[model samples]
Each structure stands twice: as C-alpha cells, then as structure tokens.
Target: MFAPQGPTLRELAVQALSSVERGYDLLAPKFDRTPFRTPDAVLAPVSRALRELGPFDSGLDLCCGTGAGMGVLRQVCRERVTGVDISAGMLAAGRARAGVTATAPRVEWVRADARALPFGPVFDLAVSFGAFGHFLPRERPELFAQVHSVLRPGGRFVFPIAAPARPGSLGYWTLLAFDAAMRVRNALWHPSFVMYYRTFRLADVRAELTRTGFDVELQSLPELGRRPDGSPRCRLVVATRAR
Candidate 1:
C-alpha cells in the first residue's frame, strides 16, 4: 500500500509497463513514500547486528536504493562508504537525503549494475536491503561473484532474511499471487520488470553462497523477535570471503 503522497494508480501502472530502469526512474521521486522502500523496523535490527560484527572500514551498499543500508554502513564503517545501483534516479534520491548528506565519513554514489560491479577488492563490508527480488535465481551466482570481487579477502557481504510465510497464511497467498501476476506480466510485456517475492529461498541462497566462495553463517536477530514456531522471524546472513 502507498501513502497519500505516493504515486497514483495511473502513475504506478505506467511504471509497471516500462523497463525496470525507466520504471524506477519514474517512481524514484516517490519511492520512499511507497511500501517498496526498506522500512525502519527492518533496517534498525540489521544495523544493530552489523554494529556488533563490525567496526569495519570501507563499506559498500550493493543495490543500494535510496541508501537505507548505507545508513547502516555509516554506523559501523569508520572509513569510506559507497552506495551503488543501476538507477541514476534512485541514486539521486539517496543523495538528497539529509542523513546521507551529513554522514561523517566520505560518501560516494556510483551508478553501476550489481551483476558487473566496476570496483576492485576495496571494501571491508558489503550490505544489501530489500533489493534481491530484482535479481533472478540464475543471475544470483554472478551477482554473488561480483560482490565477492569487490570485497577484501576477509570482507563480508550481509543481508537479512525473513522466515518463509506459512503455507495457508495470508502472507503466503499474497506473495504467491504477486509472483504469479509478475510472471504473467513478464510473459506479456517487453523489457520486463523482474521482481518476485517468493523466489529467494534460504536453502537455495545458502547453497549458492557456499558455491561462490563465501564462508556462510546465519545469526538469529533477536531484536525482531521470533515466530510462533519458536524460530527467529528474521536472521542475518553473514558470508565472509576467506582471507
């Protein structure tokens, strides 16, 4: 659901029909007002976890739309901080944020694809938030490799994952319908908008990370609390490249 200040139905419709880049460009101005922006509730817990594991130097926010994870990086990383994404409009939106502009460490915004990052092994930490749906399962290996390439030997790439929705729950049906609609939309549309909520599974992701040279670990984030099954509702994935 969108706020009153968010894009209207017609505006959202036009965006959904456009290429991913163009759609985001059209939506970027009001993106923070939409449900798509990473919420503070999620960001706060992940930030606390990163702080405990870090005191890291040069940091990177991969697929950093509107720089939510960059804020998390600023809390843990003492040196250079950078946010990279493919959409110029999204980067501009991030640049205009008061928090980003006043960050203590130097901040850089790069417009680049995550599948083919244009940086060397320079970062000590890399974090992403609420952007994985944009990447298909087939693209994930290369994307992981690209993140691997940018970090120093012992650097980390981290992100949070919520437990799968219960089979008969409202959340599960909602995501199921959303993914089905997206599949239909992609089948009929050109320059398809590639976002599907149900595609990124924990088991598959952990396997791929292990295959991509990361020493993978998962830590429960108690700050977010647990599910009815007594499992953590959310867990942080810490995948560190070997030194």
Candidate 2:
C-alpha cells in the first residue's frame, strides 16, 4: 500500500506500463512513501545483524534504489560507502536525501547495472534490499558473479530474505497473482518490466552463490519475529566471497 504522498493510481498505471528503468525513474521522487521501499523495521534488524558481523570498511549497496541499504552500510562500514544503481532518477533522489555529515564515512553514488558492476575486488561488504525481483532467475548467475567479483576475498554480500508465505494464505495468493500478472504483461509488452516475486527461492540462491565462489551463511533476524511454525520470519543471507 502507498501513503498519502505516494504516486497516484494513474501514475502507478503509467509506471507499470513503462520499462523497468523508466518506471522507477517516474516513481523515484515518491518511492519512500510506497510499500515498495524497504521499511525501517527491516532495516533496523539488518543493521544490527551487520554490526555483529562487522568492523568492516568500504561497503557497497547493490541496486541501491533511493539508498535504503546505504543507511545500513553507514552504520557498519567505517571507511567509504557506495550506492550503485541503474536508475539515474533513483540515484538523484538518493543523493538529494543523503545529507552527508563530516562524521559519516565518504558516500558516493554510481550509476551502473548490477549484472556488470564496474569495480575491482574493493568492497569489504555489499548489501541489497528489495531489488532482486527486478532480476530474473536466469540473470541471477551473472548478478551473483558480479557481486563476487567486486567483493574482496572474505567480504560479504548480505541481504535479507523473508520466509515464503504459507500455501493458501492471503500473502501467498497475492504474490502468486502478482507474478502471474507480471508474466502476462511481459508476454504482451515490449521492453519487459522484469519483476517476479516467486522466483527467488532460498535453496536456488544458495546454490548459485556457492557456484559463484561465495561461502553462504544464513542468520536469523530475531527482531523481525517468527512464524507460527517456529521458522524465522526473515533471515539474512551473508555470502562471503571465498576467492
């Protein structure tokens, strides 16, 4: 759901019809007001988790739309933080929102595709939030490889993954319907907007990370709570580049 200041239904309809990049560009100004933006509740737990795993320097916020993960990187990383994204409008919004103080680490915004990151093995940590759905399952290998290439050996690529909604639940049906509609839209439209909720399975993601040279670890985010089945509601994927 969107807040009072969020994009209107007309605006959203226009965005949904546009290319992913153009759609996001149109939404950038009011993205934080939408449910699509990573919530602070999620960010707080992730930041706490990163703090436990860190004392890290030089962090990267991959696909950093409006820089939500950049806030987490600021708390965990000591030296520099970079927010890389393909959307120039989103980057512009993030830059405007980011009020850099002298005390905080250096922050830079780079416009680049996540599948082909333009950097060496420089970052000690990399994190992404709410942007994976834009990448199709087939593109994940290249995406993971790019993350691996940018991270220093032993550096982590961290992101949170909530447990899938239970079968027959409202959440489950909602995501299923959303993905189905997206598939139909893409099938009929040119310059397909690629976003599918059901595609990023944890098992498959772990396997891909392993194949891409990451030693993967999953940490439960206790602050986010647990499901009735006693499984964690959310977990952080900390994938360290092995070499």
Candidate 3:
C-alpha cells in the first residue's frame, strides 16, 4: 500500500519492468512514502538494540536506500557514517533526505554494489534495512562476506527479520503470491530484478553468516508482539565478526 505521494501505478509498472538498480532509481524519490521503506517502528527497536551493544565508531549502512539505516548508524557510531548503494538516483535521494551537511558524523554516500564493497575493514558496525530480498539465496554468502570484510573485528552486521507468517494466513499468501509473480517476471524479463520474499530463510541465512565467519545471534524484537504459539513476531539478527 502506497501513500498519495508515493509512486503511481504507471510509475510502479515502469519500475517493475526495468532492472533492479534502475527501478529503484526511478522509485527513489517516493520510496519512503511507500510501504516498501523500512518502518520507523522497526528502526526504533533496532536502534535500541544496537545502543545496548555499542558506543561504536565508524558505521556503514549496506544497500542503504534513502538512508533509513543511516539514521540508526548516526545514533550508534560517533566517528563517521557511510551509505553504500548501487543506484546513483537512490544515493542522490538518500543524500537529500539524510541532510548530510558536513557538520554531523560526516555522512558519505558511495555508489557501489553491495556484493563487492570497496571499503576495507574501516567500520565498527554495519546495518541494512529492507534490502536483502533484492539478493538471491545463493548470493547471501558473498554478501555476508563483503560485510564481514568491511567490518573491524568484533563489529556487527545487524538487521531485523519478521517471523514467517503462518501457512494459512493472509500475510503468507500475499508473500507467496508476490514471490510467484516475481518468478514469472524474471522468467520473461531481461536483467532479472531478483526480489523473492520466501527465499530468505532464517536457517539458511544463519548458516551463510557462520560460513562467512560471523558469530550469529538472534534477539527477539518485542515491540512487534508474538505469534499465537508465543514465538516472537520479529527478531534482530546480530552477526558479529570474530576478533
């Protein structure tokens, strides 16, 4: 669901037909107006979680579309904050919205692919918002490795993950349908825009993080409440690079 200021149906159609980077570039200006942006509610708890673990220095926001995660970094990291994304248009929008005026933690916007981050081990913490679905399951290891490579030892790669919906629930069918449609789109389209809701399983993700040399931990975000079976509805996955 989109707001009145969000992308129109025709605009969304044009984006859906383009490459992922191009599509996001087209959508950048109105992205925060759409449901696609990471909610502030989610951001708040993640910030709180990081605060308990931090007092960190330089931080990086991976796949930082419009810099939602950058806000979280600003609160935690004292030295500098960087937002890395592939889309120039998205980076432009992020710079505009994030108000990087050179007085603050020295926000830097780098146009780079997340799979091949250019920075060295310069960050004490790294955060990503709602960007993982753009990466396929097979790509998780490399993605995690890139984050690991950029983070100093004992640094963390943190993000939120909502619990998978129950089989018969509306949320389940919606994601299933969305992922199925994406599969069909990729099958017929060029330069496939890989966004799949069902493929990013927690078990698989934890395994990939482990393989990438992260000591992974999952902490429930109680603000999102719990499922009928009493399991947390949302969780923050904190993957720390070993010292």
Which has the greatest TM-score? 2
What lDDT is reached at residue 73 by model 1?
86
lDDT for each residue of candidate 3 in 1-243, tens digit (9 for 90 to 100): 889989999999999999999999999999889998888999999999999999898999999999889889999888899999999999999889976366657789999999999999999999998889999888888899899999999999998988998998999999999999999999999878888888888999998899899999999999889999999999999999995
Scored by CA lDDT, what does every candidate get? 0.91, 0.94, 0.91
- Tens digit of per-residue lDDT, candidate 2, span 1-243: 889999999999999999999999999999989999899999999999899999799999999999999999999989999999999999999999997578858999999999889999999999999889999899999999999999999999999998999999999999999999999999999789999999999999999999999999999999999999999999999999988
- State model 1's lDDT: 0.91
Q: Can you give the lDDT of residue 91 in candidate 2?
A: 97
lDDT for model 2, on a 0 to 1 scale? Answer: 0.94
lDDT for predicted candidate 3 compared with the true structure: 0.91
Task: List residue ranges in candidate 1 displaced over 4 A.
Answer: 99-103
Check candidate 2 and list the clashing pairs.
none
- Which scores greater on TM-score, model 1 or model 2? 2
**What is candidate 1's CA lDDT for residue 217?**
97
